[model samples]
Target: MKKLFYLLSFLILTACGDDKFSPGIPDIGIPEVEQPKDVDSVPVVEVPEVPEVDIPDPVIPESEEPEPYRPTRKIGKTYTFDLVEDSGIDQTKAIQDVLDKAENGYIDKNGDTIVNVIQFPEGKYWTEGFDVGLKKKYVIGLLNKEFIDIEASGATLYTKAPGHPYGGDIGKGRYSHRRHFWIENSKFIEIQGLRIEGSNTIQGDLLGTTKAYTPDFWKAGGLDRGAHGDVPAYASYLEFEHGYAVNESQNITFDNCSVYGVWGDGFYLGNKVSEGGSRNIKILNSVVDFVGRQGFAASVADGVIIDNCEFKRVRRAPIDFEPYGATGYVNNVRLTNTYLEGFHGGIAALGRGQVNNIYIENVKINSPGPDISCWDSAGKTVRENWHVKNLSRVRSYGSHVGSIRFKKTNNITIENSFVPIAKSQSKKSMELTDCENVTITGNDFTNGLYIISENSSVTAKGNTPKQEIIIE
Candidate 1:
């Protein structure tokens, strides 16, 4: 609904009369008459044929690019719920009404149990000391975080207690059990525009993996301190639409959303080194800002994609790939249109993956340390292959490693990237070691020596055709 829609009406105001005013060959004097007098006034002046006006291209505001895979329109029968329904829901009964409408044999006017669009009407609704539980259920709807606010005592969604099988362990882990909204074992779930604030977790990660960086958390390459589970256990397989999980658990998506001001990460999608791990995840159009630890993190996962996301003021790597104590390998991951600003702590992307096939492109990172990392390994077992393009980094602090480091990595290639590092950060800009099938081509290294290799040589000589770099 745009303003000033009535202006278009004037375009259709060319009414006409037949024989009443049809001037024939009028002279320079005032035109005798014409069906359209306005046309007669200028036509004697040999008015050039009017040209059709070209409509301007519609303005496309900066927005989150939607994944083409999702069903653009609603999927199922549209179900609408209001805290102020016929049920007359007040503060005490708002959450209860929503829950009762979601579950408990509530159907729409068309007898459709599967609600596709459960909407919260536009209003400021409050719930005091209310508990919303999603023990194991598939809910599909846009939870508007802009409109809903949950108190400290009220839970948006909870899976299980600490010791229960539902691993939402915040204390024993990191972001466990603190479920403002929990989804697991629940596939094809879409939650959008939901804000989860001022919540606490008992034992888990926000997305579904157990808490990490604590003593018990162990995957493959040993993360010293393991964390707990953020959400409850058994809540696997979810698809977040536009939800925000702050200081919650793992195994969730923050698509077109933001997560901030938490004890943990904006979105930490990975199991600890001790556990198996989380997998097949995607986080796009999201922001992980002002948190304690990493932003858009993936510790023990496979097939992850974080695209068009932003991270600001995070403790650890803004876009981290920490696979501690991994077993098989971490593979087929990507991050595009992603930007990381601020060095709450270390590397922008701390990729310690097992195998290869980890790619990053179109990334702009500003940090106190290195931008890309493939360092830290216990043995010569796995070779993580990465392909990076259109990457830009502004380094302010780093010393032990290079901006584009590859220690336990192999089969990696970075092309058309700009790495401008401060000498104070490190005397070196790039380092390669113990890697095979490596190539660095057409990279703009503005500071420090452009290259560093250990027992390696260029595969081909002076091949700017595409700028290939090889480090054996």
Candidate 2:
């Protein structure tokens, strides 16, 4: 009876929402009820008090020391100029004046003209790019002993409106007549320590009411005047949005430079109209950012090296060896330790041209589209001899897109890569069609099925998730 009386009294007190309730107990109030006749003799109960616990305030340390200042690389002869005081066009003319007055163009033992050193100080000089010729457009020469040295001391050169005239069309046999940093048929041109800005402007008015593409009749040599046709024979041209165009040049180097905000490719190295093809070229510690097309596009080249470069936000591929014309044969190209992000395709060599001895190692790819893609549109036995290793894909979207693709190529190898798959990525990680002698080894395809091949010349060894190899 006493226990029952105590239980009823406890319930009644808890229902009253009294401040006397213990911390651990819920303060639920109870409605008034008729008292039982024998409830007067109930004993009161008390909850043990929780010991007053204390928590100390958190301690925050002082801010970390500032990172050590690293200096930029210094090379070649250095000069100073003020861009804020002059218009971009005037600044270009000023730099050209310096180039002209620095040294007279001289002929070397190889019968090539040489233009000596030109260095611009740290400033943002805005203008269209420049054209460096041996003597005339058709003249042939070798750049002798550092023939043209341009050192930009942490400076930026931008292309503004009414920029240089159109240089030429990309793959097709067209001509823009205007030039944008058109370094023609020469050698030993070393440019370094600069950033190029295209400002995303096409500058179509630079044509000045002239048509971009020549009529078919004009191209057939039927539009000849009393002399010769005033129009270039092949007259289709891309817009003036190129950052650098190295045409039929050899032994050229671009070091510690950057290109950004261009409507077209950042770099175009081609041999469409040149007397000779490009050879022994290197692009080192460079960056291509925010370009509309390929970051670095080359055609008809040999012994090209791209090392320690970063490509960001290029709408197309980061690196492409594209042969749009018959003269396009890319050979002996190496890309090492390069990083690419935010591109449709990471790397590609496309066309019906001979591409050989291409090596890509230590490449990181994270893009919205295919990380690596190669296609032979012409369907000939054109692409060959490619070796790629140490590829890493940091992120993966769903399975609709592929990480790697090869179509109509032969003798390719991809090894030592990390391809992590998520549930969202249901598509195959690799796609190979009409490829021959493909070797895949030492790779991690644990999260996703590896390859979906159409034609079987596929060899696979030493890949993880071995039991789950899906061959469709």
Candidate 3:
């Protein structure tokens, strides 16, 4: 019985432990494998630490930024002011109002005003006078900031009777008396293709006219104090009428313009109240006809260039470089390709002020009347010092005023020129009085004497003097 019971238990245990034979009992079949205890037997890997970095923002270019609005024209906006023919109205106030409005218009993004160009249509405009680039009340400050271009093609600006009467004494022993156009304390101004007509009809000497020579006109005009003997009151009366007067300005240009029948100079470049002077003035392709005084006169000026111009029937010299102030000077003047006819003189540099660096080339002088003075002291001190300098190539035809004289001058060079004898007058062709370091070469003095004073130091070479070379 014990053997049968043990065999039965063994059979039961073997059946329970048999693979895939258990039906209802829970079965945890696979056991996890244990890791190795020897950690050095396996290989190990190492890693390095990383550093921190900073990144900046991207940059922007200048072209990518917003641009300021620019006008279509080169300078700025253009303003047009027109007039009617024979209007018989004084256009001064209306024109001045237009100028004021144009000058003070809207400021752009570039901080510039609206006034750059002023245009006038074809018409005959009557005006008393026009004051440009000046303050409204006082004669101070500049009106326009940028350049001003006045285009008045085929337009005439005629002066009214008693025009610009008594402009009320500006300082520096000077008066801003009369001018068809006065440009002061400004720069980069251009007047183009305009005609200016003044009141005076007298061509030659002002004294020759019955209207100007009378004591009533002189007394009425407050010009009687300065007149003495044969000499008219030029200092007082000559300041009363001018086509264009520029004061303390710079870079002013007059192109294709005409100035006629003016009592004073056609163009007067000067300064007021010791305010430096006018500088870099240019007159191109212009005409100054029938003027009472000089065609173009400069006092306290520098860098005056007159090119392709004509001066006819001027009572005084065509060009005068006489400083009116005590501390004034005229420097760097160049006149080329010009025609001067029917003048009292050719060119004059007077006054006590200094005149330096004058250059004249390809100039033709025709029918200059009885005073052809080139350089004179004008009753000032007659010293032996050389105060004036010149270089010229001039040809004088028809009747001349005795000779082309140079007195108290230095560093003169007269070359490649012609000076003929005075018609019906026994005079020399050229005269050098109290001059120094003169070089007269390649000149044709036909049938006329070339006179040099004892006080002159001259070197005459390669000159054609048909008559004698006299040393006075």
TM-score of 1: 0.55
Least accurate stretch of 10 residues (summed lDDT) in model 2?
Answer: 226-235
- Name the candidate that leads on TM-score: 3
In model 1, which range of ten residues has the least summed lDDT?
A: 233-242
Question: How does candidate 2 score on lDDT?
Answer: 0.65
- lDDT measured at residue 140 in model 3 versus the true structure, 0 to 100: 15
Error of 3 at 381 (Å): 8.4
The residue ranges of model 1 lying beyond 4 angstroms of the native Cα positions read 1-74, 77-115, 121-179, 198-254, 272-279, 344-355, 395-400, 424-426, 457-472
Error of 2 at 419 (Å): 2.4
Model 2's C-alpha root-mean-square deviation from the true structure amounts to 24.1
Residue runs of model 3 more than 4 Å from their true location after superposition: 1-73, 104-115, 129-145, 164-176, 202-239, 370-402, 466-469
TM-scores, all candidates, are: 0.55, 0.65, 0.67
Q: All models: lDDT?
A: 0.48, 0.65, 0.65
Error of 2 at 304 (Å): 1.1
> Per-residue lDDT for 1-472 in model 2, tens only?
9989777777887788785853445647887797767876776688899998888888898899997655432333434454553442535656555554543234555544545566677877655433332122211122322456778867786654222233443456443333335566667778888787753422222212124323333334343121111111111233334567777788899999888766566777776635557788999999987665678888778899999999877666788887756556888999899998654557877775777788989998876667676776677655777898998887764456557778877898989888666667764667888788989888876566657787748888888755233555
Candidate RMSDs in Å, in order, are 23.3, 24.1, 14.2
Candidate 2, residue 48: Cα displacement in angstroms equals: 99
